[model samples]
Target: MNIQCPNCQSIRITTKDEGKKVGGVIGAIGGGIHGISGALKGSQVGRAVGSIAGPAGGAVGSVAGAILGCLIGAISGGVAGAKLGEIVDQRILDNYLCQSCGHSFSIICHAGHSEPKIVGANFFNLTD
Candidate 1:
């Protein structure tokens, strides 16, 4: 669907996606914390697994496991955070920008209304 600016009827619009950004960051942080907890277990497991190779391998494995754990945690957390943030942007933030008018707005659904309406204005006073 083509969204036009309510004030100027311009098709050049940008979605703010503020919520998604925030959510993604938050989720990632939470996920990273979990990953850290997991990392300890991962390090133990890695050491045992790598020890089969040799003494040097065991030492390498422990470090590798910890790094892997941290990486996994950060990545998962970031993705989750971004997804949640997107939902917030759509549902709560004035997520649309009219390039022509520089007006920020959100598409809102009214109760018992069949169609969504373009609502709100200049929430961010943003310029590009």
Candidate 2:
């Protein structure tokens, strides 16, 4: 599933994809670092063993790593996403004048497949 900006009617990236993308990037980085460390220690396969060993160490470590990566990624993605949303929101407000007042107004952002709420009336005002 995906989320969309209410004001500009643009599709925004979803948390799920953001989290996974972040996790994958981090995991690869971690794995590379671990491998480097392993190579330094002469483990032959170095951190390359993580791919196979990750599961064998039980789901705990693997899950922990992924979750840790995800959390970091999600937070980072969320902040960036919010900023991007703001840009879109501003564009919408600047371009799409209010029907009633014919004045530019801020947008009210929403998530999921729900309908778009009016810019000024929603609980979470995207303008702020």
Candidate 3:
């Protein structure tokens, strides 16, 4: 099915994949920063625990703590990034823009029906 522009009745439309890609990149960067923060916190805690156990113990504990922290941070960051990307995709990247009149809109479908409808048009106040 073809989607027409509400402003000019043009069939030329574009999807917002570029927006999605931008969102994904932003999410990944945020996630990486969060992960780094988590890793630093984990290492600090580990070092403290190791110091109480003496020099050798502290050294071992710090290494173990850093490794564990890094793993946890990476996992949490990845999940958070994926969620953010999905949110961006839904809220900003899944739109259909009119190429002819420079109008931005979306295609919506009601429940129990397959036909999509166009929104963002001032149908009641159409201009010649």
**Highest lDDT, which number?**
1
Stretches > 4 Å off in candidate 2: 1-58, 94-128
Q: Give the Cα-based TM-score of candidate 2 against the true structure.
A: 0.30
As a TM-score, model 1 comes out at 0.79
Candidate 3 per-residue lDDT over residues 47-69, each given as its tens digit: 78988988887777777777776
Tens digit of lDDT per residue, candidate 1, span 52-121?
A: 9999888888889988897799889899889888777777777888888787776654424565454543
Q: What lDDT does each candidate get?
A: 0.77, 0.43, 0.63
Q: How many pairs of residues collide in each model?
A: 8, 1, 1
Sorted on lDDT, best first, the list reads 1, 3, 2
TM-score of each: 0.79, 0.30, 0.49
Model 2: per-residue Cα lDDT at residue 36: 46
lDDT of candidate 2 at residue 128, scale 0 to 100:
40
**Clashing residue pairs in candidate 1 (N, C-alpha, C atoms within 3 angstroms):** 19-85, 20-85, 20-86, 23-81, 24-81, 24-82, 28-77, 28-78
> Candidate 2: lDDT over CA atoms?
0.43
lDDT of 3: 0.63
Per-residue lDDT, model 3, residue 44, is 76
Per-residue lDDT of model 2, residues 26-123, tens digit only:
55555555444433443323234455666454444444455555455445545555555455544443323433333333333443327544443343
